[model samples]
Target: MAVNAHAASARTATARQPRLRIMVLGLRGVIDVQGGIETHARRLYPLLARLGCDVEIVQRSAYYPRERRRRGWRRITLTYLWSPRTRIAETAVHTLLGVLYAAVKRPDVLHLHAIGPALLAPLARLFGLRVVVTHHCADYEREKWGPLAKAVLRAGERLGIAFAHWPIVVSPVLKETVETRYGIDATLIPNGAPMATPRRTRHTLRRFDLQPWRYVLCVARLVPEKRQHDLIAAFQAARPPGWKLVFVGEIEQGDGYCQELIAQAARDATIVLAGYQSGVALHELYTHAGLFVLPSAVEGHPIALLEAAVYEVPLLASAIPANLALPLPRNRYFPVGDAKALARQLEVMTQGTAATTAERRALHAAIRANYSWRKAAELTSSVYRNVARGGWQHG
Candidate 1:
């Protein structure tokens, strides 16, 4: 049988009996948080709301702040809950609070993103709320986690799949893992990418001291697993003359990883670290890039890569399973962590001859055909609809 990796097309005309209510947990905040899960929620919940599902995403107050709390974006309601800003306690505290809030409000379904927060799936179920968990990635595989944290993450995955009324996996690779290991089949609803408008002006380019179509761009948080250090090494080895390398991600905070990366970028005149940009600034960067690269050692259906593909930028990534899932030429990929191979590809790709108009159209068509917000939301709402029908229940 084919893998359950398909999403429903956004059939806007579908009819429904009294609307379904969904409470979301397990995210920092959808308002420009650094992780891919944030991006997923930012794109998803509004569409869910539009699809006749009553959607409310519970966010950590630390990230949303007092003034921004309880604000609604598009059609979706943003509900803020308290949590410590510390990495370890944040998800646990916020989600525990979110579950209590859900118990009080009593939504029909609770949607949790990522395994960390999904650790509370059993608790959510015990509280008499139908639970749906989206496994964004295998958090245990990340390099930053210590043994205890990794063990906790493994337990999170187990509890999330075992207790959820419906388990959703972001990619087929993850779907297979859940089935092989836990003997549970997951609904595979892939991550969605937005249709972005290209910034027509050169203001952002000039601000970053970058020339149009003369830079290689990589957008990811400066984490070890993301491997921005490896990208920097590869770019230096390539030294694609006249063409600068630009990094677009969070940078102001001085964690050990961020400090090392900031100092490294400072050494190279051609390397630019454009810190924490969104909106038009990010759109413009996508529009004018000569090439886009994602050399991360870890990923789960990257939205950034899809954003680049939407703009028809020449794509290159590490030969990881997630990156390989994208439809790019095989030659576009270098071996994972292989700076020498990446450099060789970079040296040859410096010209950045963009695809023709026909190619650009085809890329947009492919995005519509494959990854779409409307479709993913429709698929997610179907889970809510099923929960309303009172068939699947897990203890």
Candidate 2:
């Protein structure tokens, strides 16, 4: 839909039928990968489009292929902007460029995802764009960032909370943190998880020499805070017969932690490093896995764990505040970074006394009902409408 047409229609509509032109920033491009924020964008914008909104996503040029650049996906326009590839420079530079673009395009709302890109929220607002920031996580707490980077991220959070027309947080813990720290009443819009159909193909399993219901799976970035090392140690200690342990995500560039994981996995033939996977391959792994584990030391409502729940896979996770917030049984949790405790839990799960089939089905239904992309889209669209009407106020 044309920008002018959308704006004109929105102006003519009644209060209840307001259409919005939205521009989203802060993702590393979408339509072909599996990062938490990126996956959220890929699933959300399309649903927003169905709700009578004109949504356009701004992507980093470096992440998109030459052919895929300048194309639209699912009625959402793709606007590519260039940025430096370095971690410190990537989000700031890309968001600056995207803000300038939004300034020219003059969208009804500029929705920024993640606190890193939200550093530019004030700048976007200065250009007369209504800004809505989604606080995906408190990035400064992540182990990867140094003192200087952490300071910058904290500053970003403060600026985003103070300047944006509305702020949304994915988890209740984060919502309370922001409320207490910044004294801002932000909207609580958690991430959604869609139930996936099991893939018919066994190519992903055959490639790794894995068998149906004979392997444990974890799909997360190989970072220190994710604590893949602890999971590896627990799996090694459990030593479940005939079961493989699979790790399915790429390591950060220039990070030596993945190399450590690779060396550790090499000590056992039963362990497989499948690297990054999505779509069918990822679905297959989630579908037939004997168990799913999320050993993260930190998370902002983990999409991987929610996906595992959608597939009805038995779950084992750390007892972090974020993980504990999920609708899971007490027995499914182990002490954070406790390999021995995790091993004991794993042994019990592998012994076939985990959740029964009826319980699994009920859990699956609850998960699907709780996290709905359509509901997220509707709530987000309401935010846009409120911002457009100048009726939104922070408490």
Give me the candidate number with maximum lDDT. 2
Q: Candidate 1 regions off by >4 Å?
A: 1-15, 352-364, 393-395
Worst 10 residues of 2 by lDDT: 1-10
lDDT of 1: 0.83
* TM-scores, all models, native as reference: 0.94, 0.93
- What tens-digit string does per-residue lDDT give for candidate 2 at 1-395? 12223334442342458568999999988876557898889878888887768888888888777876767889998888899888789998999999999999999989999989888988987898888999988889888899999999999999998888888888989999999998988887778988588886899999999998889999998888889989889999999888999999875566689888888877889889999898899999998898999999888888888899989998999998888888888889999999999999988888865678987787788888888776677677767877876744452
lDDT of 2: 0.85
> Candidate 1 lDDT, tens digit per residue, 1-395?
12223224334334535777888899888887777998899888888887778888888888765765667888788888889988678888888999889989989888988999999999988888888899998888898899998999999999999999888898888988999999887888898778878888878899989998899999988788988888888899988878889998887475888899878877888889898888888999999999898998888888888898888888888988888887776788888899888888888888555456676567667776898887788888777777666745344
Superposed Cα deviation of residue 84, candidate 2 (Å): 1.2
